[model samples]
Structures are given as structure tokens and as C-alpha cells.
Target: MTHVSGKRLSVALAVAAVLATACTGGGAAPKDAAGGYSAQPKQTGTPKDGGTATVALTPGLSPNYIYPYPPAAANGTVVARGLLWRSLYRPSGEGDQIADAELSLAEPPAYSPDRKTVTIKMKDYKWSNGSPVTADDVVFSMALLKAALAESPANWSFYTPGQFPDGVTAEAAVPDTLTLRLETAYNPSYLLSMLTLLYVMPSAEWNIARTGGPHLDYKQPKHAKAIYKYLTKESESQSTFASNPLWKVVNGPYLLKSFDSTTGSFSLTPNPAYSGPGESRLDQVDFKAFTSAAAVLNQFKAGNLTVGTLDSSFVSQIAALKAKGYNVYGAPAPARLDSLVINFKNTVNNFDKIITQRYARQALQRLIDQQGYITSRGVYNGAGSPNYSTAGHGSPYPPAFGDRPPYPYDPAAAEKLLTDNGWKVTPNGSTTCERPGTGPGQCGAGIPRGQTISFTLASANAPAFVGARDVAFASAAKKLGIEVKIVTKSLNYMYANYGNTYAPATKNEWAMQDYGPLYLAAGYPSSNTVLNTEGSFNLGSYQNAAIDKLINASTFGSDGKSLSAEVSSLAEDLPVLFLPTPHTLVVWKNTLSGPQSSFNALISFLYTPELWYFHDASGARP
Candidate 1:
């Protein structure tokens, strides 16, 4: 799963800006530049090879686990992991095109005619420990993942039962070649897309057999549990980051040199034995942690940090940063969307009865002023328009959002829909079901007469923008006779309390949730883990039999039409009220240069840091 940062401040400032304009009925405000930022800073001479670059991390947030298997891994961990390890493919290109996967550790895979077998040719790379990376390491890594999945199937939602490693057999016919023969034919491209997230670990150091047996027996639940516990515990401790013998082996650009657990800060030195492409031009890289977005800006302003991400909350400050000679680049909004997920199974306060109605959901969608919320939240200038589909605007399948025009901000339409559904509107816009029945103009089954349209919306307390949006949304809902109560909590708390696997009793507490820009891996853009009935990320436990069939078809279907049709259906269903995709702003010292592409939207500015380097004061590479 892609990491989501919960460090943005409230959008009070944005809301104030919008209120001020509306109160005065002022003309359009001056528009900032709309295009995205460049991938690298301007350079005059050859690239320098030895300067240290300091990057900024979110305040109060640090890498909790260096390993990638756990869903709780933070953005800092994702960025750092890229430096320590190499996947089979990496994100390439820019803007929406950045989702393209480029070969990294191996050549393009060769598939058999039936597409059941895929043969991958390994690159002649060596780990930092001087051991040659071979086919056996890849097979062993898969075995470890399988064992980990056995303990927690949700860890790898892409793994189908009796597929891939279960029915498939991996054979290292030669030191460089690994062949995977599957029992059933699968989409070769989709399989490769899934591999983009599979980090190939050196088996000699990660194997469970080193502790007891020759290899982990994934069939044994105890062995799987033991391996997961040991690996997770080892990776969670900051002390093990630099000292753990298991972590010393690597094949990427850098190795952890030091870590400060107290400050959530760490430094990496170039790996001398690294055999991957784009060698580290800088001798050392330091990740500095801040306490807030303001602190991060202050550090960048004071010339203390070389690379940093400018939060959207500080869009107004971009001009000032550029005036001070910082190179500001706007990354394409990640292929993620922040949404309001309505829990269909919520038994709390009989909200499920109201939420289960298609008219109610449709009315709520129309009641949302997406553009107003974007402007009031200070995200309009940097984000794309409101999305209607589950997949982002940049997803591979172009969604033909069925014949309906984008849900307009029409409170009248919302009111009409509620009234037609037997909701009695009050002068203040509060509503109650007047004619509860089992027919038209009546509330659905289980809904009683006089049931008020009310529910609590839980949103992240940080990233103040979301809070502002929630306020705006609540205000609008008031006009539609809907009572919306807003509750703000930390992102961690929100996920733990209302996440996909949360207990039904606990998950039903909140009627709706506003979080995310939930990122999906590059090339694998299907919403199986989000909208499917058994989706691991289905926080709302929404189940539609038709949707379930479509999701399954999209996942296994080889043709693009089937996937497009699924996206279209999701758009029509509106499982979650879609929000705009915000642009990711990357701010850096004018002297540093590097590849700025990112596969995940949440951490778009921190991608491919190994290629980042510094030039001398004369605008020339030293």
C-alpha cells in the first residue's frame, strides 16, 4: 500500500480567503501559474559528484518500519527504501504519464504463448555485501512474501488463492534466469505491474530457515507468524536500522549510515558496491525531520535544507520561496483521490437505512460543492477538477462516466430528491422521513417515519484543508436538510479505528470518512482492494453483487474494455463521493538537481532521490 502523510495544517486560511471573497463579491483573484514544476533545477555545466543534500521529512512523522510489507510504513520509509533496495521495475516519466513502469533489476519478462509462464532475466547486479544477485534470491524472496502473506493475507491483496506462487512453480534454470509457470493463464502485463511493488530481498540474510529450518514452511502457521513478528520487530526499531546485520545487504544507491530515533532523522551514504543504474552523484544524503509544514518552510527559507516538499497548505507562499531563489516544481496530482466514504453497513443511529438509498447517495453527491470546497480549502489552484470515478483522472482506463453530467452543486436538486423520497423538509433545511413505506415516495425498508437525515463525518485533524472542506461540506449539507456532524482525529487513529478490517461494531460508529488521496501502485490501477465486496481497503464494507463481478472481471480480464466498463460502473455507483486530485509541489534549493518523478501521489516530490545532486554557486556543476 502507498503511504499517506497526515501532516498538513487545517484549511482555515483557505476558508477565510474564500469567505472574504464571497462577502465582498470580489472579482476573480489573480491566478498563479497552472503548469507543473520541472523535474530538475536549471544547470549550466557538468553534474557534480560529491555534495551532500539534506531532504525534509514531515514533522513528527518518521519511518516506523523500514520494511515495506506492513501497510503502516510511512512516506519517509518509502523514500528511504528506494535508496536501500531495488524493485523489478521503477516509476518513470512525468505528469500523469509517471505511472509507466521502467525496468530496474531485470530485463522485460518473456511470457509463454499461453501467458501462464513468465521468464525474467536478472541483471548482473551485486548486493552491497558483495554477493551476486541471482535467480535463487528472487525465488527465495517470493517464498518469504508467501510466508508473510500466510500470516496476514491482507498484506498482499493481489495474491489470489492457488495462483502465482501457490499453483505456479519457479525454476532457476540458470543463475540469471527465473521461470514462473502458473497453473492458469494470467494477464502478463498485469502480473508484471504487480511485480513493481515486490522488492527483491537477498535471501541469505532474510530467510527464516537461518533461525531453525532450511527454509520457512509457509504451510505452518507458527512459522509464518514467527517470521512476520521477527521481521516486523527488527525493522521497527531505529537501533536496528544501521546496526542490524540483516539490513547490511543491499543493491541500491545508498546504505543507512546513522539514524536518530528521537528526532526521526536519518542519513544515508552512497553504496560503493551498488550495481543499479543512475549511481548516486552525491556522496551523502541526509533526511531532516520537522515538526510542522511551517518549520519545513522556515528551514528551506533559511537555506538549511537542499530538497523539500511544499505542502498545498502553503500554496500562497510559493511565490515568496521562488523570490528567495528556490526552485518550485508542481508534480501532477497523484492518481489518488480524497473521498467521503459512506458506510453502507453502519448500524449506528439507523444511518445505514438512509445511506443505502441510491437517491440519498446521489443527493449527497450533488450537495457537495467540490469546486467551492477546493477553492475554500486552497487546493483549487494546484489540483485538477473534481473526479467522478473511483480511479483517478490519470488512471490507465479512461472512465466514461455514464451519461449523467458531473454532479452539479445544486442544493435544489438534492432537496427535490430527498422530498421525492418522503423526506419532510423544515424551514432550516433539516429533514425527516414523513411517509416511510415500502413504495415510491417513502423511505426504504427498516427506515421509520420521522427519521432525521443526520450522520457524523469523521475526518483527519491534521491537513487542516480536510477540516475546512468538512466544514464547507457540512454547511452545504445543512442547506439540503441533512445534519452532518464533523469529528476530527489523527490519521493513525482514523485508520486503526475505521480501516478495512476494523470490527463491524467499531466501524459503524462513523457515518462517513474523509481521508486519503489513497494511492495505488503504478501500472496496477484496478480498484479491487477498495470497491470489491471483500476488498481489503473497503473501510465501509460496501457490497454490490454487480460491482463484485465487475471488479473480479477487471482484475482477471486481459482486455481493456472490461476494465473501462468496471470504472464506468463505479463512477455511476459513486461508492465514495470523489474529490479533486491536488498537485504535489516540490521545493528545493536552486543548486540541487535530480529526477523528480513519483509513482505515489502522497510523496510525489521525493521520488528517485539517488539521481539528485548539487551544483556550485556559479550555476555550474563542480
Candidate 2:
């Protein structure tokens, strides 16, 4: 589920600078079937007995919160949540599948004939504490997740009003099995996608509200809330993450070893008691945080970094990198989209009214140079593909978004739109409304005469391309008299504080935001909590009854075309100004040997270090 505040990608997978790479590789470098960067680089070495692998945390993103279900404002990088606990269903890095059946904590869910009841059978897994990962743990997780949402929808991005986990009731019928009865039936695929986010914790060990406190029944709502508060409070102390006993008890392959408070770097050691399928071959995985992409590139050049992403701006350095014994591979991240997130609730300068106008949004979207950004050496640098809809490239759910964009880059068309809407377009000045009435060809309701097409665009400071593209957009908008005030914020700060749903104080502070990418769940990329009217992650409060209906049809109805209808409608409606799907250039040392799936996980904002190990070029343990 893509978050508004940057998560894994950028905010919900928080931000990836919309990148593009026309060049797959120079020579000897591997390539995917599409002739793009290979998801699975060929391995020359045999599996090592045990070795350490250093992974790079995305620039400007650090794991600040340890608790899996932290508030949107408290959520940090996906690395934090993923490394600490295992979700019920692990996301299959393959673009075609929702979950990796073998890696998941539970077997594929079996739905009743009515589709309201789902029975899940747990795998033979155990927490580091040696307790079986039980049905009670699943129920406990659901209870705590519900409690978090009860506090505020801002607590969870995937939540929609009165939806899954809201009206759903769960019970552990047996030690290794659980059943969920939903008040409303959902598409089996959509429900499965939702379950992918349910990370299971050690219920028996974490049921206490205080350190050394007596264990309490977590099924009770009040007790769950108390335990949640206590756990969240404990997560606030960054320095104690490695030392905290509560954090050490894990169900995943790795356990927290040490955490650097200043740099946000952390080390993990294999969980000796991990009962999952993976070898947990790596002795230790070190995640290093950096201040910028340039720094990361420097480390790559110096051979100091093993696994990290290369910003598109550094695409020219690919050959240089490959020559340095590194494998450079990249492709558009699956089920992801980059967009200029507009805030529909912001009434400042009548932006809410102005932006609600279809033509106004079309005009603004037209000002974006998607192709220019992709081709510009300063921007995406031929590393991304143009995207115009919520359902990203190569989506299985066919998009009604035509081959040609509904609103392509055309300054003249943009100018005509403003002028036709009764705005006085000044080529080098502010375009102001001349007609105020809410009638045909007049400025919409509450937009008084003299209203200007101007708004603050909050751009993420990292991933250099984000700012470059934003500046280009602003420059284009300026030609049509749209005044775009550019303000830069850190990627982490944007993910933690930019959205109006979570940060009420910032409601009027920003009109548009570009933090990076919003990653939908793999395989089934539904726009339930993203574009829905009451969506928890609907950061801009974009409301359209028709869109809401379409979203509902896709989410609740079983019609195969429902999602396509939703995606097409969103494409035409311009819910957010969709940008290109940037290719994330994943760079790693050639010595690392693992299944292609492990490297592919990076594209989905998931990390599987337990499956990765360091090996020598000659197929020997390093």
C-alpha cells in the first residue's frame, strides 16, 4: 500500500526520484527479457557458507519508528518495518504475483462460498523466542491494528472507513489456523492484497503494556490500545532499538544487532531460532544511511558500498560502476506511480475551488513535461517511462488510459484552458480569474474574480531529479501565468509531515506535493485508500462521487472490469497529476549471490537480506 508520507518508495514507499534509463548496460552487465536492467543478475560464484552483506538504506530515509503499525507521521522507511517483523503474506517481488507462497507466514487463504469468511493456515514458523507463530498472534496483530486506526485514520494509510479490519472479526479456531469474517464481501484478490500488510508479531511476549508488566489479553480492545501506546512509546527511543528486549524478539530471519542513532544505520544478525524456509545465510546485514545520492555514488566509486540504489542522474556512471566490479540493473518499479499530489481541501486562495475544476486540473497537468523530464540529462535521464494513470506500467488490470495521454504537454492548450475558464492569462505574470460566477465557462464556486492560479509546490529535497523536474514544471507553468512557489523539504520530513490527513497544521501550507513514488500493493494495485473519498491516505481530500463509486465497484464488487474502470476514470479525472514511472537503478556488488527474487524485492520496497550472502567471484564463500 502506497503511503502519502514517504514510506518505502518515498512516502508510501515514500519517494523514488522519477528516473529513466534507456541504456540497459554497457557490456557483460545482465539484462531482463525486455533488454532492460536484469532483475536477476547472473551469479558466477557458489553459495557462501556465511558472510556479511551491507545494504544501503534509501537516501534521506531512515528507520525512525520500530513498531510495524506506526502512525503515518511516525512511519519511516519500509526497511524498519520489514526487517523487524514478517507480514502474514510476503510480497512476491515478481510483478505478476501478490505474495510469495513459500515465503509467507500463512498458506494461501481459503475463502468461503460467500467470500466473507477467509480461513488462513499458519506455516510452521516460530518467533526468535521459540514460541510458535500462532493464530493468536494473527488475531493480536489485527486487534492492535484496529486500535491504532481507532485512534485516528492517520495511524494507518491502508485503512478506508468501515472497511477490512474495521468490520472484520477474527478468531483462532486452532493453534495454527485462524478465520476472518467480513461484514462485507471483497474480491478474493483484493482481500489477499490487504492481508499482505498484516505483519505478525510475538503476541505472547508483546502483550504487556509496560516493561516488566504482567501479560494481558490483547484481544480486548482497551488492552490492545494500552499495549500499542506502550510499544509506540518504546519505539521513540532510537538509541535503545538494539538494546531493547522487546525489539529483539522477532519472527523474521534477522534480529536487530546495533543501531546508529546519528546516522540511522543498523546491523542485523540471523535469528538462530528462525523457523522459516530461508537459509538466513548472511551472518550480518549492515544497512547504511546516507545524506544524499551523491554520497552513495561516491561510496560506490570507492567500492565502499555493496548494495544501494543509483539515482537516475548518475546513469552516466553505469559503465564506470560496472567496471568497478558492480552489477547495475534497473527497471520501472512495479505497481508504482509518481505524481504531483494536489491538496483538494486547501481553501487558501480558493485553490480548493479552482483545483476542483476539471479544466483547471487538466491545464495544470498539461504543464508537466513528462517526456522532457525523461529525456533531460538533469532530470530522469532516460531512466523512466511516462505514466498517466494510477495503475502503473504493464499492469494486469487493463487501463482505460489510452495509448495517447488524455492531457499531454501543451502550453498553448493549457493557456487556452485558463482563458476559456474566464481567467486572464498573462504570459509572464499571474493568471487571475476575471469571471467569478459558477456558470458555464466561469470560475467555479467561491472563486472570486482576481483569483490567481498560484500554489506552493512542496518538493522533496533528495533524489535530485525530484527538484529538477519540479523546477521544470514550475518553469512551464510560469509561461501560462501559473505561479508555482517551489519549496524543498527532506524526503523523510515530507513522508512524516506533508499530508493534510495527518498534519492538520499543514493543510493550508502546501497546495501540491512531490515526494517521489506511491507504491500500490503488488499484483492487485487497487486504489481503495488512495483515491477513495474517505480514503485514509487521500492526502489531498480529492472527492468525486463518480470516482468514489468506481473505487467501491473495484474494491467490493467482483466485476473483472471494475478496477480498469477505476483506473481509466482516475486517468481522465486527474485526481493527481500523474508523472512517469521512474526506473529504480538497483546496484549491488557482483559478489552477492541470491535468488533473483531477493534483488527484485527492492523494486517493491521489500528487503530479503536473509536470502542474500556474500560469495567470491570463483563461487566460494568470501
lDDT of each: 0.64, 0.79
Q: Which pairs clash in model 1?
A: 8-463, 9-464, 10-464, 11-464, 11-465, 37-329, 37-330, 59-290, 429-481
TM-score of 2: 0.92
Give candidate 2's error at residue 232 in angstroms.
1.7
Which residue segments of model 2 deviate by more than 4 Å? 1-40, 72-79, 618-622
lDDT of 1 by residue, 67-136 (tens): 6565332222343755677666554322223223343688777887777778988888899989888887
* Strongest candidate by lDDT: 2
Residue ranges of candidate 1 with Cα displaced over 4 Å: 1-45, 71-79, 93-103, 157-168, 208-226, 377-384, 402-405, 427-429, 503-505, 595-606, 617-622
lDDT score for residue 130 of model 1: 90
Evaluate residue 598 in candidate 1 and report its C-alpha lDDT on the 0 to 100 scale: 28
Error of 2 at 267 (Å): 0.5
How far residue 2's Cα lies from its native spot in candidate 2, in Å, is 12
* Residue 150 C-alpha lDDT in model 2: 81
Model 1 is weakest, by summed lDDT over 10 consecutive residues, at 6-15
